[model samples]
Target chain A: MPNINTLWRTYQNLIISAAILLFCAIGFITAVFPAVEKIQSLLSDTQQLTDDTKALTAKLTVLNALDESSLRQQLSAVISAVPTDKSLPTVFSTIEGLAAQSGVSVVSVDIEGDTALATASAAKQTPEEKMLGTRTIPFSATIEGTLDAIQHFIALAPQVRRLLRIRTFAITFPSDAKPVRISLEMDAFYQPSPTSLGKTGAAIVTLSDAEQSVISKVSQLPQVSGADMSLPPPLMGQMKPNPFAP
Target chain B: MSTSEINLLKRSGNTLRTLTDLEDKLRVIAWWSLVALLAAGIILGTAFFYLSSRSDQLQSQSAQLGRQIDAQLVKEGILTSLKQRADVAKNALDAARPWGNLFPILSMIALPTQLKSISIDESAHVRLTMILGSVDDAVTVVTNMIALSGQHTIRAPQLISFVIKADGTVQMGVSFIPTL
Candidate 1:
C-alpha cells in the first residue's frame, strides 16, 4: 500500500550494496582464480624439471670419472686388429709372413669369397655381433712344410693383425723327408665402424668383464706397419731414378 | 466524524507500519551483505598472497634447475662419446678371436699321441682328429681334454668318435668350443 516513491527510497541502498558484492565476486572469479591456476601450473613444471635435472646430474657425475684417453687408445688398438674393411692384401701378407717365419713353403693362398663361410658363420652370428655391426668371411691357404713349421704357424695365426680363425686343416705326409702338404681353412671378420650407426649425443655403455678382457687381448696384437697396410706406391706415382740420365 | 474519514485514517496508519517493517528487513540484509563482502575480500587477498609467494619460489627453483641441466648437458656429451668409443672397442675385440690358449691346451693332451689334423670354425669351435697307441693313451688324452673345461678358455669338450683299428691303434675325434 506504500507509494512507489517511498518503496524506491527504502531499497536504493540495498540495491547499491548488492551490486558491489556481485562485482567483487566476479572480479575474484575472473582475475584471481585464473592467476592461481597459472601459478599452480608453473610450480608443477618447476618440480618436474628439478627432478629431471637431478637425475641428469647423477648420470653425468658417473660418466665424468672415466679415463677417456685410455679408453680411446684401447678402442683404437682393437679396431685396428679387426678393421672394418676386408684389407685383403694386408691379411694375405700377414699369412705369407707367418708362413715364412715358420719355415713353411706357401703353395697357394685362396682367400675365400663371402659365400664360402656364409653358411657356417651366418647361423652362428650372435646377437652381440648384430649390435656391434660385424660379419665374417672365410678363406683358405695351402702350404708345404715340416710338422714343426706347421705347428708354429698354427700357434701364431691368432696373433696376426687381421682377425683369423682356422676352420679346418688337412695334411698329407707323402714321405718322412719330403715336405708335408697342409690345407688350412680359416675365417676373417669385418665390422662396420661405430660411427656408421649415425648416432649423435651421449649414450650409456656397460661392458662385462669378459668383454673387457677381450678388448685387452686384442689390444696386444702387433700394430700393422703403414708399409704393410697400404698397397705399394702406385707405379704411376712412384719416384724413380731417371734411366736415360745418371 | 464521518465513517469515510475514519477508514482513510486507518489505511494510512497501516501503510506507515508496513514501510517501517520493510526498512528493518532491508537493514538486516545490508548488514549480512557487508559481512559477506568483507569475508570475500579477505579470502581473495590471502589467495593472491599465497599464489604470488609460490610463484616466486617456483621461479627461483626453475632457475636453479636450469643451471643444473646446462651443466649436466655438457657432461652428458662427454659421457656419450666415451660410451660410443668403448662400445666400438669392445666390438673390435670381440671380432678378433684371440685363441692364445689353444696351444697350451693341445700340449697338455700330447701324450704319445699323433694329432692328425685340427680345425676351428668362426665361432672358435675346435675339432681335432688324433691317433693314440692304446686305449689307455686315448683315455688319458680324453681326460686331459675334459679337464680343459675348468679353464675359462674352453667349454663343452665332446668326444665325437672313437674307433680301435685292427692294428691295436685307437683313432679319436673330439670337438670343443673356445670361450676367448
Candidate 2:
C-alpha cells in the first residue's frame, strides 16, 4: 500500500475539486436558495404595494375634485325624495298639500305596518324589499272630491318630491249629486343610509345620465313643509345622571 | 540512443502529461463553480435591495394618499350616500306605472261626464265605467279603443258589461291595460 503522503500527492486535485463543489452545494442549500425565495416573496409584496398605491392615488384625485356644496345640495334633494328614514311628518304634510291642491277633502288617513320607530340596528327587510333594496311604508287615504279633482290627485301622486307610488285606488260614483269618494293605497319609499364606507382604494363613480334625469324630475316637483320642520331644541339643561329615572 | 530505449522515455513523458491535464481540468471546474456562485449571490442581493426599497416607497405614497382622502371624509360620505340613494330612486321611478298617460286615453274615448268611475291598479289595469248617451256612442268608444290598441296605446281591451238602464241610458264597463 502507498503511504499517506504519496496518496495525497496523487489525488490532491480531485480532492480539491470535490471540496469546492461541496461548498457550492452547501452554499446553495443554506444561503443562496433561501435568499432566492425571500427575493421572490419581496417582489410579489412590492407589486401588490404598487397596485395599492395607484388605486389610493386615483381615489384621492376623485375626492379632491368633488364640490362639497354642490354635492350637499344634490344630496339634500335626493334625501327629500327617498329619505333615509320614515319622515312621517313630511309624508303627512305632502298628502295634505296634495289634497289642498286638488281641492279634495280628506276623510281619514291610516298608516299600516310596524309603526315602531327605527332603531340604530339594521331594519329588517322583506324578500321583495331586499330584492329592490328599499323599504316601504304603506298607508291608505280616503278623500272625497269631484271627478276632475280626483284625476288631478292621481296624476300628481307619483310626481311629488316626497316620492309616493299609488298602489291601488277605487273611485265610486253615486247616482245623486254627491261628491265622488276615492280610496287610495300608497307606498312611501325610504332607504337607510350606508352603515359603513368602502375601502380607501375603492373607486367613487359619478351619477349616470339616467340617474341625473331622475333627480331633475323629482327636484322639479313641489316640496311640501310640515309645521315642525325645525330640529329639536338642543339640551340646554345639565345632563341627568339617570336619564331613564323619570 | 537505442529504439527500445527511446520508446520507453516517450511513454514516461506521456504519463506525466496525463496527470497534469487531469489537474488542470479539475482546477478549471472549481474556478468556474466559484465564479457562478458569486454571480448568483450578487444578483439576488441586488434584486432584494431594489424590491425592499420599492415596497417602502409605495407604502409611503399610499399613506400620503390615505391622509388626503381622510381629510375629506364628510364630502366622501355625502357623495357616496347620494350615489347610493340616487340609484335606488332611479329604480323606483322606473318601476312606477304612470297613470298620467292613461288619463288622456280615457278622455279621448269618453267625456268626463260620461266616465262615472275608474280604477287603476299596480298591474297597469284600468277599469272604466261610463254612462253613454246611446248605443251609437258605445260603438264609437269600442272602435276608438280598437284603434288605440292598434297604435300600441292599449292592449287586451274587453267590454266587461253593456246594460241599458231603465232611464234608457247605456252603461258600459271597459277594462284594458295601458302601455304607459
Best by DockQ: 2
The TM-score of candidate 2 is 0.86
lDDT of 2 by residue, B1-180 (tens): 778766232337788888788888988888898888999999998988888888888888889888888777777788778788888888667656676667788877888788888887767788999999888889998999999999988899999999987877899999998887
True-structure RMSD, every candidate: 10.8, 5.7
What would the per-residue lDDT of candidate 1 be over residues B7-56, giving only the tens digit for each residue? 34244778778866766676677567567656766776686677667667
**Which 10 consecutive residues of model 2 chain A have the lowest summed lDDT?**
A229-238
Q: Listing candidates in order, what is each one's chain A TM-score? A: 0.66, 0.83
* Model 2: per-residue Cα lDDT at residue A178: 93
**Cα misplacement distance, residue B121 of candidate 2 (Å):** 2.3
Question: How does residue B45 of candidate 1 score in lDDT?
Answer: 66
Q: Compose the digit string of candidate 1's lDDT tens values, residues A116-199.
A: 342332445566556655555567889888766777777778676666666667665452567777788876665533322112
- Candidate 1 residues lying further than 4 Å off, grouped into runs, are A1-8, A51-72, A96-107, A114-133, A159-161, A171-174, A180-182, A195-217, A224-246, B1-115, B120-180
The clash count for each model shown is: 3, 0
